[model samples]
Target: MDEDSDAQVMLRVAAGDRKAFALLFDRYHASVARFAYRFVGDRARAEELTQDIFVKLYRNAKAYKPTAQFKTFLFRVATNHCLNEVRRGEYRVTRSTSSPADEDEKGVEAVDAQAERPDEAVAGRELERAVGEALQGMSERERAAFTMCRFEGMAYRDIATALEASEAAVKSLIHRATLAVARKVEALQAGIGPERSRA
Candidate 1:
């Protein structure tokens, strides 16, 4: 279903059709749910928030404008909803994703990083933990920037559009986030408190 462009589905959805909404939901629900769970750990809350966003999409479909990329619009909706609900204490803050699939992914990345020395598995897990802790400590905007720009490999311009910030501001934010995360990882590796490191 992802093969279908969001704009095309959105156009149909905007015309008082439910099939388009169904297709969009099926196409996006997993990713949105995963993203929500990554941003907020509670499974129930993530499901609730993801559903609410889709509902909002349906209710607001008539106002859809195709001028912007659909991703930016969708994420903007998710981000704003997550931030607002977070502020309202409706969801629990969580670490980065830690699914069974993610464990397999680390195994794959590890294979690529050092397939010759598989004994580094423990060290790799430790490093992954350090990174996850660092990500967990970031502000929502910083997390969003770090996740979208680095983890998701989005361009700075796209990130700026998704985040609704100037490109320079987005760049600075990502730079700062990366630096903070690196410092945290270094502190963890060195067995030192993160407070003593550059942030």
Candidate 2:
């Protein structure tokens, strides 16, 4: 749906229109789940978190202002929920493996397993693990901003609104997080090739 239509639907949702609410859920569920998965790096927990986030959104629908774009507003809810979940220490962030089928179910584009060389696939997994580990080491705000900007492809302005931070602050957070993740991935790549020790 277009932005204005989304806002109108949300207005209907705020008025206790169940169908409108369902429509919003259908439209955003996958993206919300993917954001959660990227945030926590756990598919099962991400699923749980997505459900919780939607429940919270339903309860708080009255708080939504039509002035904000629905996508940003939805992500504001999602970003805050994710930060709260992590801050509560509900789970430790870890690299949870997902099969290609599983990622596909979540609307993630999984690499073609048949097309990739086995060694390249292994390297890709290692890089994912490295990036996940780097994310795990980040502060809550940094991680949230980073995931929104990188994984979700959100603009900095939208991310700033979702994060309730200044655009400059969001920029700083993403920059640091990106640099850290890049360093980890680079180190992992360096270790994978010429640096490997021979038995």
Q: Which candidate tops TM-score? A: 2
Cα deviation at 151, candidate 1, in Å, is 3.3
On lDDT, the candidate that comes out on top is: 2
lDDT for each residue of candidate 1 in 52-85, tens digit (9 for 90 to 100): 9998888888777887666666777877777777
- lDDT of all predictions: 0.69, 0.77
Model 1 lDDT, residue 84, Cα? 79
Model 1 misplaced regions, further than 4 Å: 1-4, 90-92, 95-121, 187-199
Steric clashes per prediction: 0, 0
**Global fold similarity of model 2 (TM-score):** 0.80
